[model samples]
Target: MFWVVAAASAVVLGVAATLAVVFWPKYPALAFQPLADPSRVAPAVPITSRFAAATVRGDRAYFASVSDDGTLGVVAADTGTGERLWGNPAAGDADDWQQLVALPDAVVAVSAEDDDRRRMVLLDPGSGKPLWDRVIGDDDTLLYAEDTVVLVDREEDRLLGLDVRGQGRVRWELKDPGSLSGSRTTTVLAATTPEDLAAPTSAKGAPFAEPLDDDRRIVQIGADRSARVIDARTGAVLVPPRQSVADPDDPVVAHDGTLVVAESDNARRIVAYDLAKLGEPRVLYTAPDDNTRFEHLTPCGTDRVCAVQTTSSDAKTAQVVAVDVAEGGRRWAWPLPDTNNLVPVGDSLLAAQNTTPAKVSLLGADGTVRWTRDGVAARLDGGNLLRFAKPLSTYTDDPSVAGEHLGDDAVELGPLSGVRPATCAWNTAVLACVADEDFVLRRFAG
Candidate 1:
């Protein structure tokens, strides 16, 4: 009887040990660590208001609150103390604060005054006090901003550089600048017509959508196909305007401090001209064959640019080839046929697949595929790796985001089961999401 009792006890202990080993927390190294909880700050947004949007600037998180009275309020929350301030920082009494853009020390809130006029308000991060308010044309868009200058498209025909420090004053205006959008990391923006911004087939769409290697110079193209590179900071013309572009296939791209334009005489040849002197066109890359074409010319790393080469044959194969900008030769090639976008996260690359199920791969600096996750949609936003279990559908489903710092081995992004990440906004410092009409702020420890 003693022996039987001992054997039963040992069996129960063994089973418990096995369960613990198998059920250990997974993805603990790939997630975010929340610094606050619901009980601390409780809800970041008030219960009386619906959480419309949220953004993080500096050390504070801003929330857009919509009340039943049909008024929108900009609320601030202290990330350090988990304190949601009562001051609703705003300028005009616009009905909707449609967008919030975070800068170094201020937050810019854009609201539509009417169908013909749009208002932009720059607010202080601490007290939500108004620093500047400017009413722009309805056709104008807040294209790109850096430091103190906010670049905008004026009346769909010009570039307006507004000084944030000067209360949205027009520091510089470039008339007839054509359609120009700013790059995220670089000042080199593609100059195109207003119509090309909406059409991809025109070879003028998504110029500012990709990251650039440098920001010292900006590339501007005219409607007449003339291209030039200018000083990004001062808007001083560096390369004289020349009809250097070939056709729709060969566009002028600012890369590696050089103007990468196609040889005007030979549409098939591509060259890079140094910004110091537009002396001679250095051969950067050329068409591998007539049947293959390159798409999405992006800067993958320092002194390196990559493009997706797709074969037009029956097989329809695609591969990414990285070009050594210095050597003017191929560095490495990786076969990722259905690649949707090659997003640069710090020094690594987050390769997203355009397939139905969505295969996401984290590629190392040397083009090595470190890890790949299937059946999940992924995005690099605010320099954070955001992921969804399935395709996000706001109409039919409530999608949640599981995110983490791209380079760190952090596991999970706080406790985000009830939060809506689609409407959430994040920066390098903080993440703000909504849960059941309230705002949820999650911070990361560096």
Candidate 2:
């Protein structure tokens, strides 16, 4: 009788454990903690006086700035120790070092001088030694991905692909020209074919097709709202220029190589073009006409993309919705008030609010808020970590300081008295900031 009772109790406990495991809600593994004291924050090598732009690749931080003497330059520094690695003091006569493309082994600096001459300089990442420099016409645009450098030459009406590490050897050139109509902005999106996506893995764990010379495609969107898709290897026109849209904003490549374009017509809708068949694009999804507008679209996960939708012209009232790019359906939607930006941080999304009493919220993939921190202006670093700041006062004459926080912790870094907004760059291991007259770089404590 005792053995029979024990057996029955064991079976009941097993059933209860199974039910708990099956019904439990799973959440992302992300947490926020208070930052350390500001006085303890370390400093990295001082960059040029006025910082224009900065980006991090690997362990180096590349910055474009104008010196106190009014000269434009590019500087590379060790992100960990604030040590100066290389400096280009005379990048250009004009103070327009617009873009820096950082790769694993090289950094390409793009500069437009006063003569409208565009220059592309490839430098060794470690030594800062110039590998090669090329001068292209002012109308040309440069884009880099993996080991290939793509140049959209508007003057010649051609798209050129060259080996990134080679001596400017042309891999292929395709002629697909369209006018920008004085529009200054153009975007190039690189994608792989469906077969390449499913190719066997190489020894390095990347898809075997990734290293193939001819497996990529380039989609170029001009300022005039015209777009073209070109084969990267043979310069073949996969999709011609006639597939232009009337109102095109953000063009993102889906995982399956579909070019997704958000078009705002009488009604806002998402149109997708299969790169394999650049014919008539199919409407992926459409927004119901209720003052609805789609602002931006970004990758959410493997199968879906997130779109920031605003009900009115006021950006302060916005909601993020995840849409299935392949199946054409809404997955989830989350409301965010006063949203300044929506950045994907790790497996979560960080919604930064721009209004008074600024707040940052971490959102899960399932549209749940994991945590929220107030009284801070936050931005995502290159590594997707959060860097926060709080202004001391609005009065410029006041000597009040802006408090800086590395994470969600309460510990403040040494305050920057009199600096209203401090520009910063951070990775998982280090935080570099320019506050008032100081450029400080501090390491993260384990």
Candidate 2 lDDT over 176-266, as tens digits, reads 4444354445566666443333222211112212233335667776666667777665567787774465333463554456777777666
Clashes of 1: 12
Choose the strongest candidate by TM-score.
Answer: 1
| C-alpha TM-scores of all predictions | 0.69, 0.67
**In candidate 2, what residue range of length 10 has the lowest lDDT sum?**
200-209
On the 0 to 100 scale, the lDDT of residue 69 in model 1 is 47
Q: Model 2 Cα displacement at 135 (Å)?
A: 4.7
Alpha-carbon deviation at 20 in model 1, angstroms: 38
Residue 205's lDDT in candidate 2: 17
Candidate 2 residue 224 C-alpha distance from true site, Å: 8.5
Candidate 1 lDDT by residue in tens digits, 269-370: 456767556666778777666666666666556667666667662223767667777779777778886875665543456666777776777776777787
lDDT of 1 at 320: 66
